[model samples]
Target chain A: MKLNLRVWRQQNTDAEGAMATYEVDGISPDMSFLEMLDTLNEDLILRGEEPVAFDHDCREGICGACSLVINGDAHGPERTTTCQLHMRSFRDGDTIDVEPWRASAFPVVKDLVVDRSAFDRIIQAGGYISAPTGSAPEAHATPVPKPDADSAFEHAECIGCGACVAACPNGSAMLFTSAKVNHLNVLPQGAPERETRVLDMVAAMDDEGFGGCTLTGECATACPKGIPLPSIAAMNREWLRATRKARR
Target chain B: MTLGPSVGLMALATRTERRTEPQPSMTRIFWRSTVGKKTVMALSGLIMLGYLVAHVMGNLKIFFGPGEFNAYGHWLRTMGAPVLHHSWALWIVRVGLLAAVIGHAVSAYQLSRRDIKARPTAYVHKRPRASYATRTMRWGGIILALFIVWHILDLTTGTVHVGGFEEGRPYQNVVDTFSTWYGNVIYIVAMLAVGLHVRHGFWSAAQTLGAGNARRDRALKAMANGLALVLTAGFVSVPVAVMTGVVS
Candidate 1:
């Protein structure tokens, strides 16, 4: 099968980008979307032209490194991660437009890759427990309620892929920050830093120039990890409690 | 391994610099983030929804005749008895409702602006995964705003009332407002918008205020739909009754 791809191309962060058309034929129905891109790059390399650059580390969807907005969605035609999306979803002669995450914080690095270090900075602000890094404590040392542990683990599924940022019309990072905040704050071990975690991380999020959440919910839909929208509300609860506690 | 005197001086300097960094109040910090704004939107929406529920219940009193509806209107003013002046309780409710409206509008406007700022560039091929109600929020809000102004003019202030506008006769004024075709049109259209807004807003408010989860997702959705349907039926019932000569 053959597909027409309009891929965004940029030489560097400082360079202006545009959509470059590529016609790739003989694509297998079983091939992943990224594999299809690899085939395109291989053809470009053989032709002595600059290959299209895109980010991919795990190719298994666990590593959130593979980022692309396919046909206007954060991942591609499917809600799954870019790497996990199979070529069979599209028909022969289909036109697929691929582009980097369009956000002020995540600037285009080369082609499909956008710098996602802003997320790292937010995590650095809090997103952790400050217990000494030594021999790990026994899992059962802290008796966490099953419900809280389950909720925490669910939020912990977030891969920090910036899909929430990319999917949001406002490019808001609330869902990402909320997931990180709730993942720790819901657990017994995270109680000590709960109040400060929401504060510092939220501060970091704003400092990074992300957009505000309007409850449009495109982020949750686009999230590969299926992070629920309630995580953000949980973060809101945390922030309110933290604010009131700080006031006292 | 260490430059003792210089390091000591540097530590002191760092401490001084840290101290000089401004410590923003928790309220300021909370209101600055998208999560905070979402919380405000949710809380305010809940407040308005509560008011609508109560208002619709009061409207149902019209089914009991003019004496009952008039008495109900009078009762609203004397809510606090001799302990508090007449209409004082009503004024308090009014003030609160006004604040909620202002909070909802201001947060929505600000967040919309921020959302746009987050994405300087839009996707070349855009496809949204959000619900229809969520997509129509901005226009729905505007329609509701315009409706409120016309509603107040037609009924509350009677500035644009078609028939004889009688003071203190809440039943007659309501009937008079509905008697006109324009009144019914505006009121019915507004109610439809309200239904859509509540259908989306109620569920969203639950998520924003930390009252939602995967287990309760369906229940929350049901409740939202129920509320929207009930409100629309409840509010629209009066106008329909007037048109059918059941109330008038």
Candidate 2:
């Protein structure tokens, strides 16, 4: 299949960027989207032009490194992350426009690559357990309710893709931060630092210059793993309780 | 009433303000920027939702008897956790609630404007599948704003004009006002709007904070919708029944 591509190109993090158009032919429908891009880059290299720069490690879609906003969506035309999307989703003569996540916090590194380290910083703030790792306790010692365990697993599924930040109008990362907070706060293992976790994560998220969540649900809609928005609500409730407790 | 040119100038001025590039002031960013403001709004809005549930339950005391209703109201007014009527307790509560309401409203306005600007063309997405409530958020918000103002004036300051109506008669005034057919109709419509708004708002708010996952998304949405329906229906039925002579 022949396709017209408008890919974002930039020399470095500080460089001004714009969409550069390219035409590619003979792409396989069975090829994954990233593979198709690989073919395009191969063609570019053959023609002595610079290959389109992008981020992808595990083409299996778990790492969430393959970030692109195809035709205005966070990943592509589909709800899944960019890696899982296939070329078959596009038509033979499709003109796909691809760009990096256009968020200030996640600045464009080169072309499709973005500095998602802000997410790392936010995570560092509160997305971990502070308990000592020396002793191993029995799994059933805590005996958490089945529902709480299930919810924790669901919240823990988030891969920290920055797609939510890109998809949101306000560019809020509340979904990302809240998911982490709720995941830890829900579990008995996470109970000791629950209050501090929410406070630190929330403060860090704001300090990182990411926007707050606006209840738009676009992040969830764009999320590849399908993280629910209710985690945010739970987090908010937890935060309120924590704040009240702290005040007293 | 004859001041037409002044009104025109005022309209033009407001339009220009809307059209002007959003000047990023410190206060503006805190209140209207995508992240912080929306987080504050979602958090406060959730708090208000809690208050609404409790308020609705309190309002249901009218069915128990006038003495019960009035006594309930009196208890709420008189009760203080620390037993200091002359202290700053009441003022602190009022300030806190006021701040929450203001934060929620300002964030909503900022978000509403952003939503308008984010999609220049209406329904740009090929699939237009937003719920009816989601679509009518602006309208519902406006109606709710009006309802809230009228509610404050009617109950708090006694601005709602009805002949021979006395002040501080929240229960009696409610019954009297709702006893009229037109009043019942208006109240029912507003309550329906509230219900719709709450349904979407609750779920969407959760999504904003990032707690929403696919497994619990439907459940949270249903729960929110159910809560909204129950509270709105219960409250609206009071006025509706009285208007229809069924409550007497």
Candidate 3:
């Protein structure tokens, strides 16, 4: 599929970005979105022009590294990641605009590359268990119900992609934070530090400069991992319960 | 900043204890988060939604004719009996509603500002993945604000009434206002916005308040949509009755 592309370009984090147009011809419908970008970059390098810069790794989609808003939709029109999106989704000669994630805390590094370290900081703040490493108990030592285990596993699928933050209108990380909160909080091992965990992680999320969740459901919709929207609600439950429990 | 699985247990323990060991200061930290702001929005929104339901029920009394409708309006002032005196209880309710409205509006505006702050630059291309009702919230709020002002003038304060603006005769004033084309237009338009706003707002409130979970999410959504329709129909029915010459 031959396509016209309008790609964002910026020299560095401090530089202003603009949409620069490019043409990619002789594209195969089976090529992945990242492959298509690679084709475009090869052409740019061949012509002695600066190639569009973007982030991508493990194009299989689990790495959550490839970040771009294609034709305005995060990860393109599908409910999958950009790397998982293929040229077959678009018509020949279609014009696609690619850009980096827009967030105050996520500064543009170059073209489509954005600094998503804010997510890492948020997770560091509270998204973990306080288990010691000397010896380990069997995984089934503490029996967990199917429902709780399922919920935890579902939330555990989050890849810290920053797509939730990018997709939210308020640029809120509630979805992302909630996924992590619920993931471990639901587990038996995660219960020991659950109260302190919620309190600290919420504070960290606030510090990261991500906007609040307004329940737009876009984050859930735009999520490549199909993270359910209610992970946020579950997080809210944990936060509230933790705060009240703190009074004791 | 990331609290990756590799982080030391000592660092995590110290951070957790320092945050939650001494005091309730963690409560303060909680409110500073985007989730905290959303919790505030949900709570204040629920307060207002409660008022809307009551207000609409009171409005439906109009169909019972002037005697019942006027009596209902008068009852609002004398609700608290001799202990509080006339209008005291009404004023208290007004104060509560006013506080909720302020909380909702101010939190909304501040959160929006934070959202914009989170995204310093515009995306080269954009597409909305949220519902229409979800997207219309900000503008819907503005319309409702203006409508509240106009509504008070036309009925409560009698400042911008059509024909005779009787002080005690709320029924007549209501009829007179709706008898005019502009009144119906303003009212119907505002009511429509109200429906859309409530549809998205209530579901969002439920999520933020942690009343929603995987199973409950569907029910909360259905309830929100149902409430919006009922409230809109309830409020608009008064004007429709007046315009059709059924109640006048």
Candidate 4:
């Protein structure tokens, strides 16, 4: 398949960026979106031109390292990560526009790459359990109810890909932070620090300058891991409970 | 290689060091946190929603004839007759509604500015995202605000009334306001905006307040739709009746 691409190009973090057009021919339907970019880069290299830059690792899609807003939708027209999106999803001669994630918290590093370290800082705030580090505990040592375990596992699927921020009109990180909070806060092992975990992580998220949630559901729609939108509501419940408890 | 004695001593010293600082007040923390701000938005929005429900019900009383409607309007002023002074209850309600409006607007404005700032750049390819109600929230809110100002001037203050406005006779004032073509146009347009706003706002508030979940999602959505429909239809019926000479 042949395709026309309008890819965002930035020289560096401080440089101005714009969409640069290119035409690629002889693309196969089986090629992943990243592979298609590879083909474009190979052609650019052969032509002695600077290639488009983007973030991608573990193309298998679990790493959450790949970030791209393809044709105005994060991860393109498909409901999956950019690396997992196939060329067959597009028709021949289609003009595709690619751009980096746009959020002040996730600044563009270069071209289609944005710094997502804000997510890391939020995680560091309190997205973990307070378990002792001496040795691994037996799996059955703490009995987790089936429902709680299921809920925890469901929230644990968040890959921190930042698509929620990219897709949110407000550029809010509520969905991402909520996923991390719920993943651990539901488990028996995470009970000791439940209140502080939510309180501190939410504070960290705000300090990072991300926007507030408007419940547009754009974040859930853009999420590759299928983190449900209700997870945010659950987090809100936890935060409110913690705040009331702290006050008392 | 082994660590030097000085390095080991330095690590121990740093580990033992603790920084002491006063914790921020809970109010300061709540206002600063995005989640807290959203909680405020939810509460304020619900307050306004409650007011709308009451306002629509009061408005529908016009169909019972001018005598009944005018009596209801007079009762509004003398609502707390024996205990509270005349118009005191009305003033209290006005003050409460004003507070809710201010809280809702302030948070929305601040959050919107942050949201816009967070996503400094726009995507090269623009496709519509989210539902129509979701997308129209900001603009719809602005429309409702302007309508409120106009509504107060036309009816309450008599400043913008089309015809001679009386102080207590709300039935005639309502008829006079709806008598004008521009009045009908503005009222209908704003009512539509109200519908769209409430359709998304109600459900969004539920999520923000953590009152929503998978089990209650369907019921919450239905309630939002029901409220939007009832309020819009009830409010718009006044003008429609006046236009058709059914109420006048």
Candidate 5:
């Protein structure tokens, strides 16, 4: 298969960027999206051109590093992460426009590489088990309900890819923040820091220059992990309840 | 420091150009940018909702006595446009309210357009048997707008021509309007519109603000639905009581 690619190119954080077009021929249909990019980069290097700078580590979609906005949809119009996307999704002579996440909160660090450190900051704000980690307690000692455990695990699936942040009109990472907050906050071990977690995480999210949630469900739609929008609401309710409780 | 004729002419031209071109005010700023519009809508909508809650609470004072209720209205009018009994405070609030309504409507319009373009057949797979409130979001919003306009004309502007209002008995006019079966029915229908609008609006706004979570989406939805029910019930009860001769 042969394809046309219009990929964003920026030398550094301060460099102005443009979509630089390239052609990739003789690509196998079964090749992964990253593999295809790798082949293209091999060609670029052979021609003495600087290889396109992009983020990819595991190439299995678990690392949350192979991030790209393909053809205007985050993760290339597929329901999975970029690394999980395959060449079969495209056709011969297909033209794909690839760019990094375009958001003030997620600034481009280089070509197809964005600084998603804001998410890390937000997670650090409250997305943790504050209880001492040295204890050797049995896993079933707290006796978590099956439903709660299942729900926690579902929210725990979030990889903090910043896809929700990018897709949101408000540039809000609320879904991402909420998933992390709720994941731990719902558990017995997470109770001690629940109130503080809600407050600090919310404040951190605001400080990261992310917009407030409008509840359009766009984040959920764009999410490669299928993170639900409801998690944010739970965070909000928890925050409201915590504030009131604290006031009392 | 020699002021040549061309310099004077150039200065005059620059001054004229500056004067003719209106400076970009906050309203202009809001209208010119999407972020500005979102901010305006969020702030204004919250204010308007607060006002609505306050207004409902105050109007319920009619259950106390005609004098007490009328005094409350008189006090409100006194605060807005002052010495001539017109309170500037009221004008500020009125302007704020107008801004909220206009901003909400305008932003909603743009969002609705984008939504359409984003998913040309979004509701194609939507079940036809979905709740009336869920399916009628657009219709409910329109109906609520019409209801608001009618309410302003009937009570505030005195243009609806209810009998006792023109005779200097605004409280009695309200009672009379609610006492009639048809008027009571219209009021109930309008409240239903408010209920439907709020049902979707609350969560939708939250999403727009980026407050969603996968875990809490359903819970927030249930809570929003409950809020809508309570609000509708509160507003509907007043007219229902009057029609049933419970208030008269």
Candidate 6:
């Protein structure tokens, strides 16, 4: 499949960026979106031109490293990560526009790559359970109810890909933070620090300058992991519970 | 301006020093946190929603004729008369509604500013996203606010009433306001805005308050839609009746 691409190009973090157009011919229908970009980069290299820069660690889609807003939808027109999106989703001669995540908290590092360290700081604020460090503990040591375990597992699917932020008109990180909070806060092992976990992580998220959630569901729609929109409501409950508890 | 080893040490020192400062009170913390501010928005929004339900119900009393409708208006001022002073209950409700409106608007304004700041850039390829109600929330809110000001002046204070204003006669006042073409236009437009705002706001508030979940999602959504439809129809009926000379 042949295609025209308008890709965002930035020399560095401090440099101004704009969409640069390129035409790629002789592309296979089976090639992944990343592969198509690879073809473009290879051609650019052969001509000694600077290639478009983007983030992608594992093409398998679990790493949450690939970040691209294609044709105004995060991760393109598909529900999966950019690496997993194949060329077959588009028709021949389609003009695709690709850009980096636009959140101020996730600043553009270079080209289509944005610094998502804000998510890291939010994780560092709490996303952990108190357990022994040296050895693995017995899985059955703490009896987690089936419902709670299921809920926790559901929220644990968040890959921190920042698509939620990219898709949110407000650029809110509520979904990402909520996923991390709910993943641990539901388990018996996470009981001890549940209140502080929510309180501190939320504080960290705010300090990082991310926007507040308006419940537009754009984040959930953009999420590759299918982290449900209700995850945010659950987190709100936990935060309110923690706040009331802390007041005493 | 130059990077030095001492700069790193100075940063570490300041970090440590900041930790030693007294912690803020819980109320301050709650107001400062994004999650907490959302809680405020949800609660205040619900308060306004409750008022809208009663307001629309009261508006429908016009169909009962001037004698009954005027009596109902009088009843509003006379409510809680024996237990409290005349108009005292009404004053209390007014104050409470005022507080809710201010809280809702202030948080919305601050959160919106932050949301805009978070996403500094826009995607070059723009596509229509989210439901119309969801997308128009901010603008719908502004319209409703302006309508509220005009509505109070036209009826409550009789300051903007198109015809000769009379005291203690809400039936004639309602007719007078709706008599003008511009009045009918503004009222109809604001009622539509109200429907759109409430359609998204109700369910969004549920999520913000953590009352929503997968099991309850459908029910909450239905309730939101039902409430929006009912309120809009009920409120719009007043102006429609006046325009048709059914209530004049």
Q: Each candidate's root-mean-square deviation in Å?
A: 3.1, 15.6, 4.6, 2.6, 15.4, 5.3
Q: Give the fraction of true interface contacts kept by model 5.
A: 0.12
How do the residues B35-95 of candidate 5 rate in per-residue lDDT, one tens digit apiece? 3444455566667667767777876787777788888877776764435456666677789
| Top candidate, metric lDDT | 6
DockQ scores for all predicted structures:
0.55, 0.11, 0.61, 0.72, 0.08, 0.68
Model 5: how far residue A139 lies from native, Å? 2.6
Clashes found in each candidate (C-alpha, N, C closer than 3 A): 1, 15, 3, 0, 36, 0
Better of 3 and 4 by DockQ: 4
Candidate 1, position A216, lDDT: 79
lDDT for B190 (candidate 2) = 84
Structural similarity to truth (TM-score) of each candidate: 0.91, 0.63, 0.92, 0.95, 0.61, 0.95
Q: Supply the TM-score for candidate 2.
A: 0.63
Q: Pick the candidate with the highest DockQ.
A: 4
Better of 2 and 4 by DockQ: 4
Question: What lDDT is obtained when candidate 5 is compared to the true structure?
Answer: 0.73
Cα deviation at B92, candidate 3, in Å, is: 1.8
What tens-digit string does per-residue lDDT give for candidate 1 at B1-248? 86879888888875522335667876677688777888888889999999999999999999999999999999999999888899999999999999999999999998788777889999999665578888888789989988988888888889998778887899999998888898899899999999999999998888777777667878999999999999999999999999999998
* Residue B62, model 2: Cα distance from true site in angstroms: 18
Q: Please state the error at residue A121 of candidate 6 in Å.
A: 0.3
Question: Mind giving the per-residue lDDT tens digits that candidate 4 earns over A8-118?
Answer: 999888998888999999999999999999999999999999888889999998999998999899998888999999999999999999999988999888889899999
Runs off by more than 4 Å, candidate 4: B1-19
Standalone chain B TM-score for every prediction: 0.90, 0.79, 0.88, 0.93, 0.74, 0.91
Judge candidate 1 at residue B93 and give its lDDT.
96
Task: Sort by lDDT, best first.
Answer: 6, 4, 1, 3, 2, 5
Could you give the fnat of all candidates in order?
0.78, 0.20, 0.86, 0.85, 0.12, 0.92
Ranking by TM-score: 4, 6, 3, 1, 2, 5
Positional deviation of B138 in candidate 3, in angstroms? 1.3
User: Could you tell me the lDDT of residue A15 within candidate 5?
Assistant: 86
Off by over 4 Å in 3: B1-27
lDDT of all predictions, in order shown?
0.89, 0.75, 0.86, 0.91, 0.73, 0.92
